[model samples]
Target: MIDLEEIRIVLVAPSHPGNIGAAARAMKTMGLSRLYLVSPESYPHAEATARASGADDVLARALVCQDLDEALRGVTLVLGTSARARSLEWPTIPPRQAAERINAESGGEAAIVFGRERSGLTNSELERCHYRVHIPANPEYSSLNLAAAVQLLCYELALAAEAGPVDDPTPAISEEDPREAYAEQIEVERFYVHLEAALAEIEFLDRENPRQLMRRLKRLFNRTRLLRTEVNLLRGILTAAQRQAKLARGG
Candidate 1:
């Protein structure tokens, strides 16, 4: 069974206090408790508390973070909620698919990230997630309320958790397997940093005018659900490439 308790709901740069409270109430009704707030514009407000209604406990324990990285911390799986596609296409799935992925992870914490109500998640922020979750609505009038979105997704998660064990389509990696688990968000970010440096060293990625090259590369790696050891192997290659480039440059 998927551990509902291990799943955390993250709100990034929320603009309204009432939305936070309403979202907390929504989560509580659906059996989710952990809440992480990233640089909320206004929190600990009376409006938020009043909006939470009977779910003040969830609000009371919400972790307020300085940035998205701080909010993601140890989360092994991350799905960012985005309403529209960006300059670079991402692997987008519906709520049910997201629940399945979250349930698939047997040993790591999972996070569902909701971006700002108006702009949604920035391209860079969305890059941190393994998949982009989209809710299909009327194309003409598809604007959804922040709390309403949270409520719908939480409902899906509740159903998935209570429906008993499910058959995962992907082959389950045994505990003894080296690729048994995914790398944490922090580790993945470090690998991206290393990759960019290596690319720049090889004069492949222009430092000043980077354009969308790195973002596209990130999409390729992030969606692959890179394992810790896999990240190390790739970074080791990058290190060797950097060394070779330096030697060739006579530096």
Candidate 2:
């Protein structure tokens, strides 16, 4: 059973309040809830409410966050929306495939992260996601408004939900409760900060000339979608390394 409640549609740094409201409306129409706003340029503005048309409840309940990291908290699976090609190719899938993949998750929070209107998601931001979805559009003029992209993806998700179980015959791999619990996005961010500090302490990461080192690390870790226990274990290892360094320096 696909629990639509567990799906979260995230907007990253949206510039228009109206788009936010309209996106909420789209989600509501498709039987989806849980909208997360990551550092929108404008929100709670009258324009947004007005644009939402009749979905005021969705607008009122929207969860606003300071950044994408905060918006993705508790989300075990993250799919980013992007149109342009990147130097580093991620697991790219079409909208339908993205919806089906997310629908197949046994239980856990899944997020479809959309970017800003003008620039979309930056390369660094996209790296934080496990997969990226592309919406087919006219190649000559493929630029899509933030709200339109949300609507299209939500439509696909809605269709996938109503179409019954996916027909794929591949057996789902079993693990020790993959959905038991996952570390919040904030916890992951904290680990990255701690990891960077440790790397600097050991002279492995040069702050002055750190070029894409942290971004690469983020991709490496995000791919695994670390569980809460896994995060704690990694942090413990980080603390141990820090302590060892302190002892070596007689501090």
Clashing residue pair totals per candidate (backbone < 3 A): 0, 0
Query: What are the C-alpha RMSDs, in order, of all predicted structures?
Result: 1.5, 3.0
Instruction: Tell me the lDDT of model 1 at 200.
Output: 92
Model 1: residue 95 alpha-carbon error in angstroms: 0.8
lDDT score of residue 170 within candidate 1: 48
Off by over 4 Å in 2: 165-180
Say which candidate scores most in lDDT: 1
Q: The CA-based lDDT of model 2 is what? A: 0.82
Which has the greatest TM-score?
A: 1
Given candidate 2, what's the lDDT at residue 68? 85
- Candidate 1 residues lying further than 4 Å off, grouped into runs, are 176-179
Please give the range of 10 consecutive residues that has the lowest summed lDDT in model 1.
169-178
User: What is the lDDT for 144 in model 1?
Assistant: 95
